[model samples]
Target: MSASTEQPEHLRRSLSNRHLQLIALGGAIGTGLFMGSGKTISLAGPSILLVYLIIGVMLFFVMRAMGELLLSNLQYKSFIDFSTDLLGPWAGFFCGWTYWFCWIVTAIAEVIAIAAYVQFWLPHLAPWIPALLCVLLLLSLNLATVKMFGELEFWFALIKIVAIVALVVVGFALVAWGFHSPAGNKATLANLWNDGGLFPHGLSGFFAGFQIAVFAFVGIELVGTTAAETADPRRNLPKAINSIPVRIIIFYVLALAAIMAVTPWRLVEADKSPFVELFVLAGVPAAASLINFVVLTSATSSANSGMFSTSRMLYGLADEDHAPKPFARLSKAAVPSLGLLFSCFCLLLGAALIYLVPNLLTAFTLVTTLSAVLFMFVWSLILCAYMAYRRKRPQQHADSTYKMPGGVFMCWVCLAFFAFVLVLLCLQADTRAALLASPVWFVLLGIGYALKSRRAGKPDQAGS
Candidate 1:
């Protein structure tokens, strides 16, 4: 197939249903769940499970709305395009740019996480070395071919799945068989509620957990981004998206329940990962090393997905004339070569920053909070796009096959929810510092957009 002059048809629908399913799973399950779950449990106690379920449901509906919009127009390759066409040029511009920023910030976090994970085995190595090497590896894989990216993600996701399944299985055996710990104590489900009674921290704790639990579901909407590249999107998209609820329940809720069952929630250390703790409690000496490797793969998978989605978003923007024409260029293998390289270059900044500031915890916290804040911006834009679709395209709404369940009402609700989360960020001192730092990022993007608009002799065509 020849590439289109206006909008390059570079992405081949080569991804199978299995690939789409696993991609969605990989996007949903990230290093956040592996490492951050301990903090969430500390905040909400056992009630964090409810927080995960709630955020998952809200995001599921959000994804459904996104899916309906994408399927309504086969030409829509990414949410940015749909937002631009349905909402306006400004919505598309803001959504596309913000989403790109989201991934870039997320990539930084993933790289930092990879360095931290590597420190488990190589404590003396400089963090920047692994961080730099990881960026190069993912960059090479992503620049190869879309199919290569899919295959790479498939295997990376498979590792995460197998690791989680193993943890859950071992946890169950320890709980059921009454396996004694090194301390001569038998494991049981009573650990979940015995110490603090599930919500020991009370309603405030449960509410506080929502602030972080929502972060775990940050990239779940990535399934829609793969629509243009998946073979038979109509069949595979729904199959991948429809299974989101189940995945949320099993991976987030059940996985947490299993961990809490085997080990008391209070005993779960905030500094250590729950997955690592599970193996240790189950009397596995190598559990820490094993879980560390799994988390490293998880971080790589996240960074890989971030690179893929960001490049496609840039490609879509270029097609709409919102980005430079060069970004629309494609290699023989149908990969957005320029966009991929651009994103990879942006990732290298993470390595440089790590070199300048060797404090891993400070770097990790800054990148992670920035990523979460930017993701919230992206989610809010999606809700805004849905609201715009309702206002401007009532006919499309009437003719649509699959519609967002609550229409404009729920759009407002979700937007409100997003705003609340932002406020919570301000309430927390560490997150507040990150949010304060975020404006500098927006300023840089705005300056670039302005310069590009002037060069093109257009009135900021980004969102129009």
Candidate 2:
């Protein structure tokens, strides 16, 4: 294909390398590390770090495979589009809609969590107020130019990065300077395994952590969805992807290690945030207030990312004729206005649900677990798509600029790892409830697809 033939005028690349870099970083760091780490530590003790490392390695290869497929076809704006072309319509439709649902569900949880975070300062305030404000704030931001979205995400991500770096630095200082609690214990690495080895709860505890550990990595693939708008995707895309492993190690593994070192893993509370607890333990009277600010921003960043990604997924689906054509429309600023508004409207349901169910913990558990289930489904599809691509396009595989190492074998391994995580979900009662509740989403998608197919069969416009 010639250069002009390969490139399309309608699709412009507007994201710079800096934007791509920060997008990847923004995608990786979220409420998971800021708030969810406490729960994960409670489940598996210090061994949770190992679980995170394993999951990170598996997802790294999965992303490499996706990047390889995406870089090969300029027409592929998202993984779902590439899957459809390489596999079939079914793969495309399923991947696109499922991934969109994943974001919506995850966004709802983030919004509700944000409301809860805000309540720390204003205990008497109504939750719905903050949730509504968050939705509107993110919606307005998303309606602006894609470059503006990139800029907003850059600052949001910077806050998270700086917070984590500060935590690590302060934690190490406490350990080195021999800071002691009233109980007379100095912070040190010994906290990780001294009380009862790393796996204090035993091997079963380590395995159990996988259920929540996987959720931490849910939005890591957001970089893949941004390919359509990335400037010089060939160079910038690889640079963004190459940072995944390093970021995972820094943000998840090392960050967690530092937290567990400063305080014993067993002391971390499942219901309270570990970041807040670390500050409180360090004798900062306003730690709760400071951490609340960080958690609030983290929640906003996650919701902002959800809106951006869900809209792009809709745009890709429309481009592939899997979704309504209206969703493909772009605003003057190159934003997917229709899709953005639709997703923002859907997010309002989160506020409504929070009003109905005032029990914050219960509501958070239901939405987040469901989000994890859907994310697993999407990741499975990516692995399956890669496997299909390898089988059907051997020559493309041979000449690809970016390739998945140990192609077929790694593909199978990732798929199996996902399968194992699913089984673990089923074994855990909370996650199992989510698994039972998730099929309704697929059923709804099936009904929608059937109606759409019927509408397209009419005589008015079957032939383009």
Candidate 3:
């Protein structure tokens, strides 16, 4: 490798407290809450709220472990950085690329979602056109500078935050004033239980909620990616992580609970956004038009986030020479231009798939499962890294100010919980297929590592 290519490219620390806070907010409130909540409510009734709480709690501990690991070593670019340091090179190789692949699948699905949402306003616009345009816009913003990414996310997250808060407040006011859903069902807190009760779907439905609710929490660990670009990682990172439980309660649980209360779970259309329906029930004029715009921005925000995170993951991989060196190149603006374009290229491939696939819906069923399974690989690695850190660096753990609670015990708990979620996923045939397909990723990565190791060793033999 040439010295120029070997030069360390530092990611600019342009993101401030507000940017970190909002990006953290954006990560937690995916379109799932705004949109997928309808399906969740339909399947599990009101128990979906508990489903969110359970997934959120397990993930919070994961974040805590991640926080402690990142803070313990300022040299760590992201959690995967520490994974390599604590575990081994192969662990880093597997985790880093797996994370990159995870986001690629996520970004592709979200861009397709953008196209779907665009149809609401432009009934004739092709899905690929909007998908392509959205990816390009995010690419340009990210290419400008890291702060541009931060500012865009700040506004995106603000929209979601304001929308959810409005839903909760208006929901309470309606309950107090006794407004009825358009269906003539009285809008009261009793709506949560008046129909068939919280567990109306039975134990089966309650567990079923986990299938989709887990997807809702997909990017919650996004704060970990911002570690390198954050202005104050030690302070900002801990603040962002410590607040996950609160965000889950407010942005997810309260938001869903309010939606179900305004319109009973039975009334929520299984395929439609309960958010738009909530306002329509309140007799808010143009409710569909208004919420459609919000959901549009919601999908755009998520796709934008996936773009930013994937580029960084590739940059980290390239820095380690596990990926092609071009990905490590930073433009004059200090952004990973090559990595951004490459990720965008993969997204374009997804666009092409959307254009050519006979049934886009069937394609996404496989994509979503692959996404969930790959993310589990990355998260489980983080827990394993934490266990390694605890055992190897007890002094560091003892001296750290932002220590993970419950010590190493929580690590096992989280791992067990993740395994259980995988079991739940396997029970469903569609997700089960993805679960099986996921091992192919590790198999491929292991093969690459073996080849790379052989090549690296040959150079030493030549030198001797």
Candidate 4:
């Protein structure tokens, strides 16, 4: 693609209401649920259901706060915009770049996951091949137009929704019929409590589950990035945000419950996906392969979302002079081509990581833990910005049509919950390493922000 004589100044608002809805849906249902739920079920047992509920409810409030703030000013393209406006330029600088890193880390994990999924069919295939191929395919597709990305996510999310619904329905029928697996495990609701019960592994196990479960929700806030291109955000954004709880219950809680009921919690494989195993246990002909294909697409969908989000974030940062000025340029399609290529170049490292890390699960946990920790920072910044918005813009809050349910109080509550999850990260060895490495990102960002401020001959708000 080449630049035209007439260059558009901004991203086009071509994404429609349906696009926003499915994008939000795609964001809400992340790769973690499909790829990581087995480990969560094994660690937390049936108590994992309660874990999802707590996280879901808390994130719903976070979304509500984000929605209110984004709608309060149409000028805000994403949460980073509000972070900068409500907090300071330093907040925007840090938030924008950290968010960009967050998605890159997440896309790395998704690519590794895609390679693992491919190995289900070809056990000897080089993991890097699929990983590299996925990145290149996403780069080509995203470079076309923003609307194309939306269309891809729309279908990807739809496939996931249908697959989960089918899994639930089939699981219920098997349980009703008292279907017994080859291993002699009987299908029944009693499976939830028959073995060591919900907290069988104790509270320690339940707490350990949060580390990976937090990764499950990594992309939940993705819709916030669509504010710039979404058509009728006021009408569409609220619709997407309000339905999060429902989607969580149906897509996550119900699907996992059905899987556990069919296969029993004790029998779930830690490293393998339960979504595919459930069908294999039920003796569904070629069904496991079909489900594997669904999960592959699911991971691909997540990688696509990551690519779209990271490029746009870089674009936002450049437009504000927080990044290289050339990153601000757009292609004929109104897409940030240079930023997208830069993100893809970074993603290629993920392929190398796959080739280097012999233990796939370890690589996944490391990247995901780091990704989750950064995402929590981004979420905290949103809450902090919401508190600032409340203090600085009381008149706007009072006059606004859609208000956050608990306002500033819930912001504090969400922030506290995040802090607690961060503390939980210290429990495990793998997660602890990621946690220890996290502060280095902030240190680098602080130094970069200070230098940039000095070059511009402005007060270093980041240092202040």
C-alpha TM-score for every candidate: 0.92, 0.93, 0.95, 0.94
lDDT for every model? Answer: 0.83, 0.84, 0.86, 0.88
In model 4, how large is the Cα lDDT of residue 444?
98
lDDT, ranked from best to worst: 4, 3, 2, 1
* Each model's Cα RMSD: 3.1, 3.8, 3.3, 2.6
lDDT of 4: 0.88
What would the per-residue lDDT of candidate 3 be over residues 96-179, giving only the tens digit for each residue?
A: 899988888888888888888889889998777888888889999998889999999999899888989988988878888898
* Cα lDDT tens digits for candidate 1, 181-297: 675656788877788687899888888898788778888988878888988887788788888999888888888988888777877888779999888877789988888889999
Candidate 4 lDDT over 65-133, as tens digits, reads: 999999999989898789989998899999999999999988887787798889989999987888888
Decoy 4 TM-score against native: 0.94
**Collision count of model 3:** 0
Alpha-carbon runs more than 4 Å astray in model 3: 1-8, 458-464
Which candidate leads in TM-score? 3
Q: Tens-digit lDDT track for model 2 on 64-114?
A: 988998888877899988889877776788889888888988888889888
Point out the higher-scoring one by lDDT: 2 or 3.
3
Q: What is the lDDT of residue 390 in candidate 2?
A: 83
Which is the winner by lDDT between candidate 1 and candidate 3? 3
Better candidate by lDDT, 1 or 4: 4
Q: Tell me the RMSD of model 4 versus the true structure.
A: 2.6
